[model samples]
Target: MAEVATGTTMAERRASVDLTDRRALLACQPDDPAVLAEAHRLKETALLDFGVRDSVVTSWLYAKCHHHIPTTAVETAAVVATGDGGCLLLYNPQFFVDIGLAGVRFVLFHEARHLMHRHLYVEPELRADPVFHLAAEVSINHVAMVRLASGGLPTRAVPDGTGGTVREPVGVDPHEIHRRYAEDLSGQGRKPLSYQDFVDTDLVVYRELKRMHTPLVLPIGLCIHADHVGGDIGELPTDGETVGRIVGEVLAEAIRAALRGNRIARDEVLNLVDRSEGGGDRLTRMWGTLGAVALRGETPRTRRVQWWKRWLADTLASKLREGERLVYPKKQGAVLLALGHDPMLSRRGRERTKVVLVALDTSGSMSNEVVDWITSLVGQTDGVESHWLSFDGVVMPFVPGERVYGGGGTNFQNVVDYAEGRLTIDGEPFEVQPDAVIMVTDGYAPRVSPAQPDRWIWLITDGGDDWPEHHNPPMACHRVITGER
Candidate 1:
């Protein structure tokens, strides 16, 4: 190995970062408070105008990047997402003044979209390709125009090589890109996609352009993420591989907030969440960890022909309903996003598996069909623990389809006593405080209060007495209805 002699060693290189760069890193904002306040105002306006969900995320991305100290470090507003998730927005005040109000909106949205694209699509194959960066600009600029209601391409102030900056059109218009592709495709006599179909997703732009004979011609200026060949001087990621993981954590927190009824966060998750979530495990598994509030089909589904299923699903759902307890869902939600689950309910995470007890009244001819329904219902749902019991005068712990010898007498106290943990089966104490206790009986037993009356649910068979309903402090009582459901 040849040792090339340079005056500066590694130590000198480490210490030799420019004073201007040092000042920029200090992150001190000794600027006009009024102007800084306007920056916040611009963000709020963008959020309101960008709809609820997107605004929540855009706001979140810029939440910490508030070191608005005026510097000519870059021409426009730029967010530097560090190796960690932390990012700071640095904008040159004069550059902003040159671009005007509309351009400020453009810059803010454009930068945010860059972070979003980086976060949601971080497969190594996509990131390694240079074309991905150009395709991203096309998508973000098009979306910005539509979202900001800016009729055409939004412009930005670029350093004019003088003491100040000059306003210039920011990104390559998708319309113009489409037109170029149109000409090339026409020359080859191949059909081109309509503008609507062409610009649907970022990857769409990448794919269509790859087929074209002429290379994509991008503009020169400040694009926050593009490399040096594109002549982009804005902040670039030192390592892009971490963008997905760091931003993934942020996305999960946003989803949790959305689940907790943050409207903006919800809307944002819909737009910002990945459409092709092709991972192995389904997201519902993780969402089930959030307990009842995160259950699916709780919210009204789109109007469809299978309306009866909603009723059936809801009926089955009630058996697994959560008890009076709150839980905050944390990493399970991140896993949910990775597994591709959208926020379905409005509740924080709770600590406990959803416990469902189905006590079959073996004293009479019980509905084997009804028992099958219960078994299938619990099977379909995630995060549910099933505890089965069969009782006549005595309680016996049994599996759902297990045959039991009953028909002796109906003493409902036996089941209630077992559920409240006062009694045991096979000489072992059943100590689990179930979130839901379902008793399927012919309604002939003397009604007794379980330890948690509110947690009890009575499912009376046909020609059976629903005595528990008339009891003071009535429990959740429903009928099996004895039909081929």
Candidate 2:
């Protein structure tokens, strides 16, 4: 901040600002006492003949209260005067954040640049000329930021609305950024610009922003609420922390995906070694491994299988003929043979197989894309009963007649309870057993387990966190990824 690089003196720079020209350019001058005072203070900072104030620059700022801009603020918009009539500056950070900083700055600069060039006074060049002017404004701001970041501001020419001599940032393309921003805006049902054009350039900004710890929580919250309850679920609560909580839930789900292996990692038992209460006995909680798996989204491929041991366990129903009593397939071959046979239809007095309880994750992260697919997996056969349980933080029995909805938290244990209940000998004595308990989830489920159901198939989309990894599941557990068999 001390050394004036490029050997440029402040006076020389101030001289180029042309306060008189700027005041003359703007038809109006600041009238508000507070703003006027600030402007005067800024101008007076030019002390010892070493001046400051970069080109009577017009800036934009916005004020919001009760979801509406104050009348006083709008009235203040009429009062910008930089001595010389230059550009009228409006400060609107909130608007820019919503519309994208680069875009908003472009519009502000475009209008300011117009005033600087006296385009406003001339007969309106087409009613829509303002649009082009706005674009130019965006271009100017973009060029300025890039120049500043690259430490080449003084030498670089700003991009004009039309092509100009402005040098694109070194190793930081902007086309893609612009295009993506445009597309994102458009996808929200707004006017869109070409996103692919400067995608490379935009990534630089995105990376930098990410490095700076920019808050992505709000946008993620907006997306979740939009996808879950509907985007128009009233204005998002002003409390950003609540929004962050919502995002945390979503991000947690994404984390689950990274921990487990891809779909092929399915149909295996989780290793609940860590969660076991010493002595390597039964696990105190299955969620420890599941949580670890969910958190291991970026785990290396070689180590994924090492996290758990998978075995195709005994099948639910053994080969039963008419009057042939249930002979639990204790051997792996019997289990495999039973699995090979269709459990739905009865052949010559064969009893239909008990229903398999299918649990589905309905977290906000489990977008409809995954839900619709899981729904399709529900068996429609009259003999083979299938049940669906959709859950987030908690679980509930998905009654056959009810439509699947409401996703936020995920608790796989409740789903297991429902499946176990059906498998019990009777819903009363709990002796019946299910053929298999299939669970499809993003895998951030809470840690809990009911009585072990027969073959447990965990078809995870995102890797699951909190899946037990101590004692391996007694049955075969396969983790099929989305769109996989």
**lDDT of each model, Cα atoms only?**
0.60, 0.36
Task: List runs of model 2 lying over 4 Å from the truth.
Answer: 1-348, 367-382, 399-403, 421-433, 466-471, 483-485
What lDDT score is found at residue 425 in candidate 1?
Answer: 80
lDDT of 1: 0.60
Give the alpha carbon lDDT tens digit for every residue of 1-485 in model 1: 01111122112111121112326443544267665566556655654565543453455455644443454455455555443445555565655665566766677777777766663235645544445556777788889788777888655555789879875665567787788778878888999899888889988988987778755633322343333211122323433445556665566556544543467877766554335234434443333322212323343222222221222345446655554445446665565566454532335555467787888888755656777877887777777888898888888788766776676888888777777788878888878878777778878877687777877777777677767766778775655555542
Top-scoring candidate (TM-score) = 1
Model 2 lDDT, residue 316, Cα: 26
Error of 1 at 101 (Å): 2.5
Instruction: In angstroms, give how far residue 327 of model 1 lies from its true place.
Output: 4.9
Global fold similarity of model 2 (TM-score): 0.26
RMSD values for the candidates in order, in angstroms, are 20.3, 26.4
